[model samples]
Target: MSVLSEYYAALERLKANKPIILPKGSAINNDTVAMEAGRKRGSIKKSRHAALIEAIEQAAQATGQNVPSPAQRIEQAKTKTKAVKSDYEQLKEDYEKLLEKVNSLLLENFELKQKRI
Candidate 1:
């Protein structure tokens, strides 16, 4: 499997609450380490962003300011988040397509050699 595939699989396994075996001397025994790593990697930021937006809405209500509805705020956040995620997804798709093209070329090259007898 490609490195990306392995990494994606590992992430899925981690999400599924499966134990991910680590190499000797690696710090994977403590789940907190992984959790902290994820938090530092932007998951915490997303959660905090959501909480802050909610708080802002609440404060707007308390102050009698004309604030957008909660749904509108959520939709706005989603719209902003979609742009970032779409970039990553597009890159991933491009990479996968490149990988497929390379594999096809390799197979075709092997077939051409086999017919050279």
Candidate 2:
């Protein structure tokens, strides 16, 4: 099998907890994936096997054994920031409306007091 295909197979096996080369229940990581594919530890370099690395990372994330990829995390942060900005805008609008109402009430109270005096 091609080297890339071997890595893919190893990734699947690792995800399934049935690594052929490594001991059973080995955690899915770049090193373990490489070793399971009959490669040296640290063989899965991003410069050479970016797709394989992405696949392994996604698998690890799916299994809840690793955090989301950097791209995924950035997208999540952007979404959360957008929501927070929207909420802040809405709150500012509400605050401005309430301030106007309070100012109008205070003015009306002052006028009443002046007339009474």
Candidate 3:
């Protein structure tokens, strides 16, 4: 794998492990403070990984490596965002449909009992 890919993978691994945060307005020893700082730095590193990967990919493209076009990159990001939105919408629709079905079943049972009486 490329250097950028390796770095991105490492960041992903780090993100999988929760970062420690110091409680607000809490007193901490020097050791604890340093540890908190390290965790914060790691969080920043993880957040920047995507941007760094994009930059590296761009650089590779400039150097005639196999990299996606600028249009392709934009499209890929948009596609990902659209997919997430679509999934959310589908979930919402399914929930509504289930709720409607339950309500209809309840009404039907209620009506059937009144007719029998």
Best-matching candidate per lDDT: 2
Query: Which ten-residue region of model 2 has the weakest summed lDDT?
Result: 61-70
Flag regions of model 2 displaced more than 4 Å: 68-117
Give the range of the ten consecutive residues with the poorest summed lDDT in model 3.
Answer: 25-34
TM-scores of the candidates are 0.32, 0.56, 0.37
Kindly list the per-residue Cα lDDT of model 1 for residues 10-117, writing each as its tens digit: 444433446246332222212322242332322323343454334434544554555666799899999989998999999999999999999999999999999996
- Candidate 3 lDDT over 1-117, as tens digits, reads 654454444333333333245444322222223244443323324364557545445544554546557799899999999999999999999999999999999999999999999
Lowest lDDT block of 10, candidate 1:
24-33
Cα shift from native, residue 2, model 1 (Å): 58
> What is each predicted model's overall lDDT from 0 to 1?
0.52, 0.91, 0.55
Query: Residue 25 of candidate 1: its Cα lDDT?
Result: 27
Candidate with more favorable, higher TM-score: 1 or 3: 3
**lDDT by residue for model 2 over 1-117, one digit each (tens)?**
899999999999998888778998788889999899999998899999998888888898888886666899899999999999999999999999999999999999999999999
Ranking by lDDT: 2, 3, 1
Residue pairs in collision within model 1: none
TM-score of 1: 0.32
